[model samples]
Target chain A: METEGIYDVQAIRAQFPILSRKVKGKDLVYLDNAATAQKPLSVIDALVHYYSHYNANIHRGLHTLADEATAAYEASRVAVKEFVGASSPDEIIFTKGTTDSINLVAYSWGKSFLQEGDEIIISSLEHHANIVPWQMIAAEKKAILRVIPISDDGILDMEAFKSMLGPKTKFVSVVHVSNALGIINPVEEIIRLAHQHNAVVLIDGAQSSVHLDIDVQTLGCDFYAFSGHKIYGPTGVGVLYGRRDLLESMPPYQGGGEMIKEVRFEYTTYNELPFKFEAGTPNIADVIALKAGIDFIKSIGKHAIRKHEEQLLEYATAKLKDIAGLRIIGDVKNKVSVISFVIDGVHPQDLAILLDNQGIAVRTGHHCTQPLMHRLGIVGTTRASFAAYNTLDEVELLIQALNKSLKMLL
Target chain B: MNNHRTIKNIEQELIDDFSLFETWEEKYEYLIDLGKKLAPLDPAFKTEEYKIKGCQSSVWIHSFAKDGFVYFEGDSDAIIVRGLVGLMITVMNGQPAKEIVEAPLEFINTIGLSSHLAQTRSNGLRAMIKQMKMDAGAWQVNAENKTVE
Candidate 1:
C-alpha cells in the first residue's frame, strides 16, 4: 500500500472520479469536508465488491453466501471497535447515520433515566441533530435541558460547563467537535465533570471521529455516535458505541426482525447487546465499505493526516484573514479542518454563488446548527472545510477564486 | 387588456403578463417591480411565530384566506430572501387553489432563481411551496365539503 507516491496527494485524486469532473468548466475544489468527506477509491471499491460478490443478509443463515456476508459484516464491526478503541464489538451498533445514532440515545437513554425536572446538559456549539432530539426527549420527559455556553473563540466555555453540571444533571450529550465552527471540545474533561455529578455523557463525534483518534474508555463517555460518510465511508451507515451495561439497560430503538430474539403476538424478547439496537436490515454494503474507510485512515496514519490538515487550516486562515472585509467566525485555536467566515460586504449566499461559478464548493448557511447560528448573531456563514485529499494548490485556487468572486460581487 | 378584466380571462392575463418581456432582463425587471408594489410587511409581523424554519435568512410568512384565494405576506432579514419571496408571491398569489397548485414551476427557471439559489435555499423554497400547496389543497377540500353540506 506504501508504494512510492501511491498515496501521494495527486495519485490519490485519480482514484475519485468525482474530483476529475469539471464544475463550471473548471477543476472542482471540494471544500465541504465538514459536510461530508469525499470517498476514496478503496471505500467505493469495497461497496462495489460487497454488492457484486457477497450480496446476502448476515447472521440468520447457515448457507455459504450468508456465512460470507456475516463474516464481512462482523469483520466491519470489529474494525469499528478497533478504530474507535472500544472494548468490544458488542458495544458497536450500526444505524442510519449520526442523526439516527443521537436520536437512539436521546429516546432510549432519555426514556430510561430521565424524569420530571431531571437535567440534560449540552453545549452551545451543538448541531441541530445533537440539539433537537434532546429537546424532543426533554419535552416528552418533562426534563430540564441546560446548555453550556461557548467562548467567542468557539471552544466550550469550560468554567460555564463546570458550573452547569450538578446532581440533577442525568446525562450530558455534547459535540466532540462542532460541525459549524470546527472547534474540538475537551471531551475527556467534559466526561469527567459530568461523571462527578453522576451524569452519563454522550459525545456527538460526528466531526471529531473522522479527524481524531478516539478511545471511549479513556474519555469515559457513556455513548459515542458518528457517521461513516464524514470519514470517507459510504452514507446510510453510522455507529453508536455505548457501554455494554448502558446499552443493555436501555430499550430498543425500533422494532424489527433482526432486533428480536423471539417474537410472538403476546411477548417479544430482544437479542443481546448490539443487534438488539440495530433494528431491521442494516446498510450492509455501506457497513462493509466502512472498513475500507477505516483501513484507508489507518494506512495514512492519523498523526500525518492531522499534521497535514493543521497546515491547510493555518494557510487557509491566514490567507482568508488577509482578505478585506472577511471576518473568520469561530477562530478557536483548537479547531479541526473547518473555517466559517462572513464577508463584510457580500452575503455568504452571494459569495457562495460566485464561488460556485469558479468551481469551488463551500457550505454557506447556518450549517444545521440554527441555535448556534442565533447565538453567534448571524443568520449564516460561508464555511470552507478541509480534508487530507485537498492540496495547497487547491487552497491557492480557492483564494484566487475568492479574489475573483469578490471583484464580481463587491 | 380589456379581456383581462374577467375571471375566465385570468390565465390569459397571466400569460400576457409573462409574455410582456421577450428577454429575461425585462422579465426580472417586471418581477422586481412587482415586489416593490407589494405592501410592506408590518413590522409587528416579524415575530418568531411568523418565521419559517429551515431557512438561512430570517423569513416571516403570513398567509390568510380571502375570497377563496390564499394571500401571502412575506418579508426576510436578508435581501435575497425578500427577493425570493417577491418572486414566489408574484407567481403564486391571487391564483385560486387549483390554478396555483397546477401552475408550472418552470417560471423559477425563467427567472433563473433556481439556477442562482444555493442548494439548501432552493430546497427550502420547495419545502415552503409544498407546505403552501398542501394547505391550499386542504382548504379547497374543506370548502367543497361545506358546499356539499
Candidate 2:
C-alpha cells in the first residue's frame, strides 16, 4: 500500500508505449489528456488477456468461458464502484460513456418524472454531452432548463445557482470539472443546495474521475457518470452510479435481454438495480479491462498522481504565462491539469497544426463547450491537459513548441 | 506572360514553392507566410451564407464570374486554413469557368500537401474545391443559357 515511487513520472511514462513513439520524426508529447488519456501497459494487457482468454457473452451463460467473462465484467463493476466510493456495485450501471449515461437518465428518468413548467438546472461550464440531453428533455417535457453562469475566471456563480433552485427545480446536473477550462466546480455545495430543494443532482465526472478522488457517498449526488476512456480505460465502456432507491424508482433505460426479469406477452418485468439499465451484451473485453485501469490508478495512489499533475499544471502555466500576448482562458484556483489559452495573432487551429507537426498533440477548439466559448468571447482555445504520466519535461517541450510555432505564426 | 497564367501554372508554382522547404516545420512556416500575405476579403463577403461547409474553422469563399473567368474571394478564422484557402484561390481564381471546372488540381496530391494536411483540413479543402467547381459549373450553365436565349 506504500506509494513510494508513484511520483516518478519517468517510470510512469515508460508504462505507456505510445509515449515513446515518434510523431513527425520527433518525440510524441501528448497533452490532450482531457480528451482521452493513453492507456497504461497494464490496462492494455488486461484487454488482450480478456479477449484471448474469456471472450464470451456475459451473464446468463452456463458455459465456463461465459462464467469467466461474467465474473470479469462484474468484477470491473466492483472496481468502478470502489474507485468512486459508491456504497454497492449494484448501484453502478455500465454505460457506453458519459453521453450515454446522461441520455439514459434524461430519457428514462426525465420522461417519467419531469412535469411541464418544471426547472432543470445545468452550469454554463458543462460539456455539450451534459447540456444537450437536458435541453432535449426540457423541450420534450415542456420543462425549463436554467443555466448557472460562470465568472471571468471560469468559476460557477454559486449565488446564481442557489437563486435558480427552488420548489420548481426538479433536477440539477453539473460538470464536476470543466473539460475546456479545467475548473473544478463546487459540486459538493451544489449537491447540498439541490438536495435541500428535494431535487435530484447528477454530476458529470468525465473530466474529474482521473484527476480527483471521488466519493459518491460523501458528495451525496444522486447520480455520478464518467467515461472509461478519459480515465485510461477502453473507449466504449463507462460507469453510471445512482442511489439504489432512485435507480429502482426509475424505469428501465433499454428493454432487452439482460434488462428483463421476465418477458410476457402482456408485459415484461424489468431486472433489478444496474441490470435494469444495461441492455443486451455489453462491451465485454472493455468492461473487464476497465478494472485494470482503475487498478492502475490505485497502484499509483490518487494523491501522488494529483501532486505530480499539480506540479505539471503549475510549471506549464508559468511557462505559458511568460509568453507575451498568450492569454489563458481560465485562471481559477481550483482546477485540474488543463490549460486553455489564446494567442493574440495565432488561431487555435493553426497552433494545433503547427504543434502537431512538431510531434506535440494538443486540442484546439471549443472543447465541445461552444456556448462556454461564446460566453468567453472567443471562437476556440488551444488546450493542453496533463495526465499522471505527463512530466515536467513534456511541459517544457510544449512550451518550446508553442514558442517556436507562435514565432513562425506572428 | 501574367495574362497567360493558367490554373495549372499556379498549381505547379505552388508545388515548386512547397518543394523548396526541406522540413515540415519550414513548409508550415511558408504556409503561414502565404496566409499572412493573402489579400483580406471584404468584411461584407465574410457572412455565414458565403461560408464553406465541412470546415472545422469558419471559412468564407465568395465566387463571382467576371470577364468569363471565375474570381474567388476567400478568408478563414484559422491562419493555416486561410493559407489553404489562399492556395485554392491561387489555383482557381481568374481562370476561365470551363477551365476551372476541368482543372484536375492534382498539384495538391503531387506536392504531397494532401498527405501532409490533417484529415479534417483535407476534407475542408475538398469542400472548398467542390464549392468552387460548383460555382464555375453554375456560371458555365448560365453562359450556355444566355447563348441559347
Candidate 3:
C-alpha cells in the first residue's frame, strides 16, 4: 500500500508553495482540499503570465495582446475539452464555477425543455448548488422536484432512484460524489436508468473531477460541471460540458456581447455553441490558468495521484476507527479520499478550534449539506479531505491532534 | 446577579481569570468546563423562536426584564459557543436595562478568543450580543414610557 517511492509525494508537495507554510506556528496540515485545493506553481505561474504579458480583452480586439490573450483563452477551452473528453471544444463552456454552471443549465436548458408537472430528480447527496437551481426552475415551471434518497450508509438508494423515474421525469441531476460524505454515487447507472426514461442527466463533478477519470461521452451524461479551484486550479473558473446539440438548442443564459453574433434594433443572432453560453467578460486570467492545472494533472497522472490519496484515506480510516467515540460516515467501497466523522460528546466546532490551534486545518459543520446532516441525525461533522499533495505523516498528525483535542473536549 | 459587581467588574474578573491560562489549550479546556457547568436553558425557550440566526451551531438566547433589570439566558449546541454565551450572561445578566445596553464587552479579545466570536464567521457570540443589547434597549424604552405615563 506504500506509494511513497513511485508517487514522489514530496516532489508533488514541492510544486505547491503554500504546502510548506506554517499556519499557527506549526506546519499547516491542510485537510480541507474538498473545500478548495492549494494551487501548484504551474497554475500560479500561468495566472501571473497572462496578466503580465497578454492582459487584454478577449475575442474582439484587433491588437497583438488581444490576439495572444484570445488564443490562450480558447486554447484553454481545448484543454478542458480534452480534460472532460468532450467531443469538441464547442461543447466545453467556461463558467464562473460549478454553481454557475448548474445555474446556466437550469435557467437555460431547464426553461427551454422542462414542461408543466415534469419532475427534476436530484439526490440527497447533492450540495445546495445542484439542489436549489432545480427547485427554483421547478417552482417557476410548476414542475416537481423529486429527491433520490440515500441509504443509511449515505449511498444513494439506486432502486428508489429507479422507481422515481417515470414519464414525468425530465431531468436527473446529481452529484458524482457527495461533498459531505465523499460517497461516490453510481452516476453511470443513474445516467443509464434516466436515459431509458429520456431524462437529461447533469453530473455535478465538482468533487469527482479531482479523483476520477472523467469521460463525458462514455458516461453519456448530457451535462457535466466541475470547478477549477477544486482541481488545484484557480477559482472563478469552471467547465460545463454539454452535448453539442444540447448547447446549440438552449437559450443564452444572459444577454451580453460575447453571447451574441450580431445585434439589431429588433432582433439579435446568438453566438455559436460554447460562446452562446459564455455571456460576459469571462475570468480570462483564471480560465487560461486552468489549462495549466489540467497540464499539471496530466503530467503527474490522476492514477498515481489517486493511488497516493487512496492510501492516505485507508490509513486515516483505520487510525480514526481506532478512536472509541469516533464514527466514520459513508465509508463505502466507491468513496473518494474524504473522511467525514462525528465524535461522541465533542462538538465539531470545538474540535475544529482545538485542532486548528495545533495547525491542523479541517472542515467543520454541515459542509453545505444541511439536509444530509438532518438525515444522519447530527448537527454537523468534522471532515478531513485529502488531495494529491497530502501525506501519511499528515494523517498521523490529524489523528494525534484529534486525540489531543478530544481529551480537552471530553 | 451580583448586585455590587457591575458589568465592568465582571469584565475585569474574566480578564484576570483568562490571563492565568498562557496557552489556548488551558483557555479552551477552561471554556469547555464553563460550558458544561452552564445551566440548561428552559426547554420551551430552546425552540427556533429563541434561536440566534448567524451561528453554524444552533444558539438560542432568551431575555426578559424584571424590576428594571434585564436577565439573559442562552445555550448553544457547540460547547465552545455555549461557553461564550455563558461569558456573555455572566457579564450582562441582572444588569439594569441601560447598563446592559451600554456594557463595553472587549474582554473576549483580551481572552484571545475574538476570532471565534468574529462577526465575519457569523458566530452566535456577536449576534447574541447584538440581540441582548437590542432587548435591553427595548426594555429601557418601555420603562421610560411607563414613567412618562
Candidate 4:
C-alpha cells in the first residue's frame, strides 16, 4: 500500500455495483458505512469464483476441490493474522461475526476464569454485543459487573478505569472505537493497565479494524474480535485473535464436527488452535471472500484510507454543525469516521425517512447501544458514517438532502 | 380533550365496520379512509421546529389547550406518518389529563401498527407518546397548583 495519496475516489466508486443505482429517484448517497460497507467487485467476484470453480468443504476431504477449498480457507486466516499483525495464523479463529466472536469469548473465558464474586469491567462506550454477553455471564457466574464511566465528550475516564481495576477484576472488555460516538479509545493504554492487575482484556475491534492500523501482538491485549462485513467483505464471517496460551486455557464455545481431534465413547479430544473454536461448518464462501477484502484494503493502503476518512470526518462535521438545532454527540478529541447528532425538534426517524426519500442513506436510532443513549439523555441519533470510497460530492448531497428535509418539515 | 375514549371508540367502531371487507387490499383502503376522517392539521403547524425526531418521514406535531383539554394537531410529509399521527391522536387528544396519563396503550397491538412498524420506528413512537404524556403531566400539576393557590 502506497502513502502517496493515490485515493482515486471515482475509480473506487466504480468498484461497487450498488453505487451506480438510484434510490427513490435520486442517486444513492450511502452514508451508512458503519452499519455495513458496500462490497467492491473484487470481494463479490471472489465469492462467485469460489462457488463457480471449487465449491467443496474444507480440511476434511482428500480430493482436488477439497484441497483448493482448504487452501483458500486457511489463506484467509493467514491474511487476517497479517492484517492485525498477530503473532501466528493459529491465533486467528473464524466465527459468524463480531457478535458471535464476543459471545464465544464471554462464555468460554468468563465461564472458565470468572468465579463467584469476581469482577468484569466494561466502559459505557460498548456496543450491546460487548455488553449483554458479559451481563448474561455475570448473572450466571455470580460475578459483579462494573462499568467505567465516560465524560460528556464521549471519552472514557482512565482514572475511573484504573480505580475499577482492583484484585477482584477478572476481565476487562472495551470498544477500540465507539460505534455511536466515533471516539477512538486509547485501547493500548487500557490493555497495558489491565495487564498490570493480571486481568485478561478483550478489545472489540468491529469499528476500528477497518480504519486503524492494528498490531495486536504489540498492544498486548489478550483477545481481539472484528467482523468482515464492516471491512468491505461479505457478512456473517468474523475473526477472533487470542493469545496462544489463553486460547489453549479456554474451553470450546460449541461442539460439532471438525472441532474434535478424536471422539471416543469414553472421552473426546478437541482439535487444534483455530479448529478447536470453529465447531460446525464455517461460513465457507464468506471466509474465502474475506481474503479478497483484506487484499483490497492492502492494495489501497491502510494509511491512505485512514487519511481519506479523516478528511471526510472533518468536512462532514463542519457542514453538519452548521444546521440549526443540530447538536453533535460525543465530541471526543480522538475519533474514527462516525458522526452522531440530534436535531432538537426533529425525530431522527423522521429525518432518516426524509433523507431516504432523497436517496441519502443514514442510520438513525440508538445504533444497538441503548445504555449509551440513556447516558447521553437521548432516545436516538441520526448517524452518518463515512468510508474510504465516499467523496466530497456525496457529502454535499447529504447536506442538501438534510436541508430540504428541514425546510419541508419546518 | 376529555373525549379521547370517545375518539378511540369511534376508531374501533370504524375498524369493526371495515373488518367486513373481504381482502386485505380492501380492508387497507377502508382503514386509510377511516384515518382521513380525523381532524386535518393546519399547514402553518408543519415546521421543522415541531418535527418529531426518529421517524422515517418528516412529521410535525404541536398542541394547544382548549377548554382544559389539549388538542394536538400534527402534519407529516409522508402518508404513513400522517396515518401514525392520526392513530396516536385518536388515543391521546381530547382526553382528561388523568385518563390520558393512565390510558392503556395496548390497543396499538389490536390496530396492528405496533407489530407492523420496525423496532426502531416503534421505539420512536413510544418516545413521542412519552413526551406527550410528560407534557400532559406538567399541565395536571399546574392545574393542582392553581387550585391550591
Q: Ranking under DockQ, best-scoring first? A: 3, 2, 1, 4
TM-score of 1: 0.83
* Per-model TM-score (chain A alone): 0.97, 0.98, 0.98, 0.99
Per-residue lDDT of candidate 3, residues A206-284 (tens digit)? 9999899999999999999999999999999998999988888899999987989999999999998888988889999
Per-residue lDDT tens digits of candidate 2, residues A1-410? 64566367888889999899998789999999999999999999998998888889988889999999999999999999999999999999999999999999999899899999999999899899999999999999999999999888888999989899899999999999999999999999999999999999999999999999899999999999999999989899988999999999998888788999899999999888889999998888888889988988888888888888999999999999999998999987899999999989778878887888888999988888989999999888999999988888899999998889888888
User: Best-fitting candidate, measured by lDDT?
Assistant: 3
Query: Which pairs of residues collide in model 3?
Result: none
Q: B100-146 in candidate 4: lDDT tens per residue?
A: 67766656565544543435563356656765677667777777788
DockQ (C-alpha) of model 2? 0.70
Ten-residue region with minimum lDDT total, candidate 1 chain A: A1-10
The window of 10 residues in a row where model 2 chain B has the poorest summed lDDT is: B114-123
Instruction: Output the number of the DockQ-best candidate.
Output: 3
Error of 2 at A337 (Å): 0.6
Off by over 4 Å in 2: A1-6, B1-3, B53-55, B116-118, B121-123
Q: Which runs of model 1 end up more than 4 angstroms from their true locations?
A: A1-7, A264-266, B1-54, B58-76, B79-107, B111-113, B116-149
Per-model clash counts, in order, read 0, 0, 0, 21
Residue pair clashes in candidate 2: none
Supply the TM-score for candidate 4: 0.79
